[model samples]
Target: MRLLQTQITPFVNNFLHIDVREQPFLFCPLHGKPSFHAHPELELVFILEGFGKRIIGNQVTYYETGDMVFIGSGVPHIWLSDPAYYKQDSTLRSKVIVTYINPKVFESMFIHIKELDGVKEMINQAAKGINIFGDT
Candidate 1:
């Protein structure tokens, strides 16, 4: 990430969702670029198209289509798309579905509930980020 631009994640009805696509068009905008930002909401990201690098906490790694990751609340992260995706004549486009979970809501609804032990544990585990795979 080139910048630390932490800010309040805008939510639509207590959650934030971002989706983008391209047809036969050329040039794709940077999906979420140039920042290591953190917020109070937990994040889940599923990459449906393109490949690039991601920084979650101190972990800097590469990500491609079909990769799914969950980032805990307050963890700094960013997704930097490949250069070709931003090129004017390139056909490469990045598509991802990103969802943010409000911790206050999650805690009130699931974290402290008696029947949601598994969910509570999972949310706690997500504080360090997770890579979901295979039928999950």
Candidate 2:
């Protein structure tokens, strides 16, 4: 498997890189602002509260509370909140639980365990992006 170098961004380099070597996964709870960006890691996001549009690669779709999405590495994406959420006086809130995972860790498991072939195939499909629904 090929691994791409991680893209450096202010949100990643400054905020997300806290002791990543000790823990390859990053769990973040985000509210309000969203960043339009891409990085070299798989991302799983659960929309706890919000209503907006989600853009992944060239696909655009509307999303709301309880929505979940998985984005591939190097795929540009953003969860843009509804216009009202951007207003200073607006009381609306956008909350999301995001988890960033290093593919190398999974790759290692795939290489060592033959039983993980199914999981490996799933991850391979994720490279092109996958939208899982119904109790994923």
Candidate 3:
């Protein structure tokens, strides 16, 4: 017979979702360009309505209406309206909401379901961010 030692894992150790006290919103002027910034919380970005290019890590993607994305913590990213795709006075440039979430929240939610195993796997494979291109 082999003896096995039991080890206790701390509750929510190394994992804890960030508590966002308020909604997420980021805006830049039509001609303004912002630098990439990182946060401790995960981010969920949904384009209410707009056409712009998102630069995450080394990936640059263009998006239209209904587009959405999920950005992981500490990932450097930025969105800039493609000047070739819009006018300087257009409202489309400032319509993206980047919602933040803590990674621990995801891990905790993922632990509760067996069916979500696949989803959990997918999340692990996701890059710094995942982009959802909307139907044109």
Candidate 4:
């Protein structure tokens, strides 16, 4: 497997010099305002605890412990918990582990291949949104 250079966002810079590291690590406090933002790199998130909903473009889904979500590059998204769950002394925010990679990684594989037509189609559909239940 080829080693891909992952972009290190400022949000992750305070903890470590992730820019030079092979794999970057980002940690955000579980509680915060509800908002969505677009990323330039693909994102993988693993929820360790708490409850919330992840909004990917127009698709919104509830997530809890053990929930894992893979969001491709440039797809705007956010996670928010119900007000009922957010209270003093409550750990309502989800603990997430996120990994980001360049979209070129996929483009490098499918951007110029005729045999990868199916993958090309999936990439197109991904531009809309994709949610796979972990139980499957």
Candidate 5:
């Protein structure tokens, strides 16, 4: 996958390497123009309020409030807000909560635990990106 100009180092150094970083309030406009980016860490994103299109690998999907997605390592993706959100007069805003996870860390802890097989499988699937739905 081609790496985008925006690298994930800041997030990695500031959040992932230390602990699972949970940013409960993320403003969208700060992300600027949507650009495809990839990183070696897995990410979980919850949209509290927003409307946009998400590009993950070959799939392009539209999303709004309450949309939650789990993206895997090295998978190129980005969330592009709707054009209206970029307008100066528009009051619309995008709010999100993001969590970054380093699968390698968990692997070291659970690799020998047979009980965590299901969890391991899920992590493997996340490498291709997973869109969580419903209340569960």
Candidate 6:
């Protein structure tokens, strides 16, 4: 399969990054904030493949393909994939889609858009982090 890591790049004209790392899940700087850290930017993360534990704010849970979560500004988070993905000769890979949104964008959108009440409510609740599941 073609490597997904090569597709990662800074979003043009936006405060965003398409962080798609393929392997060595631990301490992979390309994963950027791999440890517990918080930023003012809101973030939405989706797992296309791999298995791991995800820690966001006060919630800790095992995650796998199709796992998606939304994190609000200043909410600390981290993605710790299984150790197998880091072993030499291992073929395991991680395909994740992480989209970061500047708080300023959210502020402006919610300020004048009454249609975003549902979205606003979700983001507000996201301060504690939100995990989405059950598409089947």
Judged by TM-score, which candidate is best?
6
Tens digits of per-residue lDDT for model 4, 1-136: 1222334344443332212211111222222234466655666666656566777777877877677676766777776665556566654444555655555555677758889888667656766556556573
Give the per-residue lDDT digits (tens) of candidate 6, residues 1-136. Answer: 1112212224423556556655456333644535666767787888888888877777889889888888888877677888788788888878877787766666787889999989988889999998888783
Each candidate: what lDDT?
0.70, 0.63, 0.55, 0.56, 0.70, 0.72
Question: lDDT per residue, candidate 3, 40-113, as tens digits?
Answer: 45667777655667777668887665788876656666766556435555443346555555566567877787
- Reference-based TM-score of each model: 0.78, 0.72, 0.60, 0.60, 0.78, 0.79
List residue ranges in candidate 3 displaced over 4 A.
1-33, 84-93, 133-136
User: lDDT tens digits, residues 39-129, model 1?
Assistant: 7777788887778888888888988878999988887777777776767888777677777677777788774578987777887888778
**What lDDT does candidate 1 reach at residue 28?**
21
What RMSD, rounded to one decimal, does every model reach? Answer: 3.9, 7.8, 12.0, 8.9, 4.3, 6.7
Evaluate model 6: give its TM-score.
Answer: 0.79
Task: Report the Cα lDDT for candidate 3.
Answer: 0.55
How far off is residue 34 in model 6, in Å? Answer: 2.9
Better of 1 and 6 by TM-score: 6
Checking candidate 3 for backbone clashes, the offending pairs are 18-102, 42-101
Tell me how many residue pairs clash in candidate 1. Answer: 0
Which ranges in model 5 have alpha carbons more than 4 Å from their true place?
Answer: 5-33
Could you give me the TM-score of model 2 versus the true structure? 0.72
RMSD value for candidate 5:
4.3
